[model samples]
Target chain A: MADHQQKSDKTVHRHEALQKKLALKEERKHHNVSFIMMILLTLVAFYAISSDKIGDSFAVMFILVLAVVQVFFQLYIWMHLSHKGHEFPIWGMASGILIAAITVASLMGMIWTS
Target chain B: MSTHASHKKRTGLMDWLTTVDHKKIGILYLLSGGFFFLIGGLEAILMRIQLIKPENDFVSAEMFNQLLTMHGTTMIFLAAMPIIFAFMNAIVPLQIGARDVAFPYVNAVGFWLFFFGGVLLNMSWFLGGAPDAGWTAYAPLSTVSAGHGVDFYVLGLQIAGAGTLAGGINFLVTIINMRAPGMTFMRMPLFTWASFVTSGLILFAFPALTVGFFLLMFERVFGAHFFNADMGGNVLIWEHIFWIFGHPEVYILILPAFGIISEIVSTFSKKRLFGYSAMVFATVLIGFLGFMVWVHHMFTVGLGAVANSIFAVATMAIAIPTGVKIFNWIFTMWGGQIRFTAPMLFAVGFIPTFVMGGVTGVMLSVPAADYQYHDSYFVVAHFHYVIVGGLVLGLFAGLYYWYPRMFNRVLNDTLGKWNFWLFFIGFHLTFFPQHWLGLMGMPRRVFTYMSGQQLDTSNFVSTIGALLMGAGTIVLFINIIISASKKNIASADPWDGRTLEWAMPVPTPEYNFAQTPLVRGLDALYVEKTAGNGKMTPAEPVGEIHMPNGSILPFIMSVGMFISGFGFIYANWYAAGGGLGIVLITMFLRSVIDDHGYHIHKEEVEADIKGGRA
Candidate 1:
């Protein structure tokens, strides 16, 4: 009877251990932090565009830089791009950005030239 | 469960209509693409006949315009791209040691959409005239053109382009997620690597085309003024968007061809690809540079010197990576045993033919020279050299290489060689003189020319060459029919193949590998062979194989889109609404239905292993 009781206790402990492993506490914490940061970044972008203190050119540049940062945060943190098993996806996204940048930049150049 | 019996009951037409199997879908792509290819070839022959003698009076000017436009559209969008997709579907999963693509149902939907879209486009010929503004369909011409021709072009391409986008995403996810254990990115076959890059190009580049087509549709159908200069629209925007997609589209067609050549050359040479890492880097680099060079096509459009030069330099920059690939192919064969099989013959021929195309491409990139070459036979020759010599030859090579794997028979080598020599010589004969013709001052897209203008001899030669090419195609058809009737079963590893695909049984089992292979290195099968094992180590124990259930929704959805496409083209609102309703209702059914799929039990798998010679 004592041995049976001990086995039951061990089984319950293993179940709890498995749940803990599956829970992803650290990842959840990271997500929460990243969410707050994203919100803060959005507010800053709005302020940078609206504020009279900043000049026009600087405001444009600042907002653009901030927007890029927000995108990185959204992709790498919130979307779990920084996690394991995401290397190929990261490569895909990076190449996509590179193409998009080149396309837009050349279009701008063409517009300027024309 | 009795699911196996139910599956067996689904034989005949219903089986194909609802199949989610990659192999069947691949065959569908091949058949449809081949049909379009023949149509496109007929158009080419008719155009050649019209040009056989100056002022031949064979076809009218209007007819000639329609023929050229339809030929280019059908060949690029319908024929070449679908055929590429066919090979991709047939080989990539097997190459990567996966049972199916990441989304098998989506794959089916893509094929059906492409098929229906092609049908919608071709139906324009009977309903009215075909699109007459050339395949590029540049505005203000396209936007200002009369009739429902451009409308068909817009709607058909929109549906087909969406299908292509879905296919691209499917491949991207499949390659990223479905590789066998220990198959690293570096370990992937060259063809898969090329496919990966091509998918990236498709994902990024196709959206531009989609947006461009939508604007054209709205402008033409609803008078939206997106390209109507009379209502505050810039025509150059259309140019920008189209070439942005167009330049990359060419790469998307050619990159897989490059990959095929690499595979064939390496296999036939009995050597590993020299400078494999460099080849991968070059592919990515070329894909990257492809976007920047779009303006090269627009240099003669008055984009100005600075813009032209920038695009010119970017265009030339692509040649560096392409050159890297060319050298790597040559070096791969440098001191290795070379087999002269039909595929290898095409591969060997591709080197010089593609180089000629590439050289002319560079020459045309020069802004000053382009003024002379643009809209001339030189430009025509250049692209044919690339598209036909590079892409078409690559398709032929890939077909020969993988025919044994797909069907359980080898194509007759003697017939294959005849197909190769005749097509190769005919290709050169047809296009080679056109370069001189362009230099001699003959413009492209003309219905007729004055006799004794130095264009007669060349045009005559080109027509004869086209007939030769036609003969070659007939020979190929006869070969396929003869081979099919013979039912000469092939061994699994035909050609002493180097990749994991050859490890599977001939007439590859529906589940692909019975046990997911544990890939240990690049050319996994080659590695095992060298280690004296002659077979892959099984990655998992024998177990039940879970397979997705086939559904007819994809076909029905495509048919709905097809009906709507026609309705939109003809401006029939009620029909459009009905078609869209069907599509939405089908989509809803797909969402709510719970299809858990079925599994092949371990006992069945064991029986298969015992009964089949894998």
Candidate 2:
């Protein structure tokens, strides 16, 4: 699963390389699109934060949502986490998020003395 | 990118100090953990002796508090966790048919960090006082306590916890990426499954402790109050964070113990594990539920009814998965050819003892009921039954079961019997009466009780039991020495073992497998034994094997951590900064140097295979 070794048959190997080139092109397109969208998300976040019409809490939530989307783009495109051999890293991040959520929930719900 | 850099094999102390081999590191873990276990046991004995008679004053109340705190801290952090890691490091790679863990260098670094951290924690005894704020290090009390005791606790655990986190990630990666060709998720041996789940728990859990410790350290060292209620900080935050880590921490210890039991039970029963998939599911469920129930530990703190009820129910729900495991073990033995070896005896013993502990656990989970049991001997007995009766027994079972493979000498069976009976009977006698003592209003962590309170006889009996347990440990130490010198060489598959680990030759090679064994199914070795000749079919032909080079940098890095931790405890900024600088320099050197590891050539591997030596 880690590797797909190329065989020494010339025509077949050339076809395989052609397929890989198409896939790379597709991935590059995705990366470019995500980069543009990420910039747009950041601008939207800035707007939410600076706009006078936005309530303080609403702006915070709006920016937080944008940040999450931006993080997905950054991780999948910039960090190449969308590539193969990234399952365990994804599992780690998901579990960390789960536990962090639990910790924040408990701290907010139960710990305050006031 | 690979190169064959020939180097001389290290011998004696240098071999031990610099070696990145998992086997040697496992033994190092065992030795250090065993040393700390003895220290913790001694502390337990002293506390028991102090409480032997009503109003006994052999040790001062202050001393008793220190002993209690250190005993809990040392046993949990330095002793039990490291011992668990020892078995994991020693056995998991072999069981998975991998040559070594994914990150051998990090593994060495983890071990040394733990060693230095434990040493730093113990140094407090010679310098001033040990941490008297309990293992949990609850806030307010931990914050207000005088001296550098809790500082040691904070800094030492911070270093140790970092090591444990690294270890957890290493195992997670190793198991995920390094299994033999045919090993699949469901086909993995139960011990590996247990270790996988335990590592996940450790990964998700230990960071909470690191965060908690940082807060506590800041409050103590820098006077940045995160825990002191007097400074408008919430003390309850500390409790929440600690138990957030602490609760899963117990599971981290016991889950591997559960794994050990699973292996020993099936091997001794000479059967495939009953409900293997259910067992795996239960193990994972237990690890997941472990985090949800930390609030139960704080039930008596007057969290609202809703909060208490939610956590209470969550706590009780863990018993369902645990119960599934208990029944699976029994079913595994049912109608099978059961051999009552020392390890098997511990596995058999663990079931009922753990059940008793579970019953008490459920009882304590009732928030209303817990008010009475809070800070009482009942709580002590409850946890001891689970920890000592459950985890310790499983560890002993693991030690006994893997002893042949580890040391290449069978421990004297007669001595094993003596050790088991003494320890088993002694453990029960020691903790059983504490339940009644708690019910009779004998509060725990106290130096003594008044005479005629119905606690005297129980205390005495408990002390006697402690002595017997101590004696049993001594007998074990003697057995290890005698057995090694006797040189009673064991066969590779001693006890007709069923796992992939048993497929190896005795004194496992540094490269664990010459040719990675193809794992066909659950009990892969058993499948081969029954279907064909017992040898694993090699997944690949003999080939050059790349192996990691051993370096002393991990050792040096750990020493630097120790110095920095110590410096932080005393507010010595120069020492702290200089020590950290040393660590930074070592890491930089490691990165800049091109230490392309050497390889075991195909000829050498072929020779070993032909000679039946690998």
lDDT of each: 0.91, 0.91
Q: Please give the C-alpha DockQ score of model 2.
A: 0.65
Query: Against the true structure, what is every candidate's RMSD?
Result: 3.5, 3.1
Q: What is the per-residue lDDT of model 1 for residues B1-614, given as tens digits with 9 covering 90 to 100?
A: 44544444367999999999998898889999999999999999999999999888888998899999999999999999999999999999999999999999999999999999999999989987999999999999999888898899999999998899999999999998999998999999999999998998999999999999999999987779987778888899999999999999999999999999999999999999999999999998888888888888888899778888888988988899999999999999999999999899999999999999999999999999999998899999999999999999999999889989887889988999999988999999999999999988899989899987888899999988888888888888988899999957988988988998899887899999999999999889999999999999999998889898899999999999999998888889987888888899889999998787788888999898898833
Docking class of 1: medium
Candidate 1 deviant stretches above 4 angstroms = A1-73, A112-114, B1-9
- Give every prediction's interface RMSD: 1.1, 1.3
RMSD of 2: 3.1
**TM-score of chain B, per candidate?**
0.98, 0.99
Model 1 vs. true fold: TM: 0.94
Model 2 C-alpha lDDT per residue in residues B154-208, reported as the tens digit of each score: 8888998888898998999999999998999999988899999999999889988
Give the per-residue lDDT digits (tens) of candidate 2, residues A1-114: 223333446668899999999999999899889988988888888888888998999899888888888888888888989889888789789977887897788778776542
Root-mean-square deviation of Cα positions for candidate 1 versus the true structure, in angstroms? 3.5
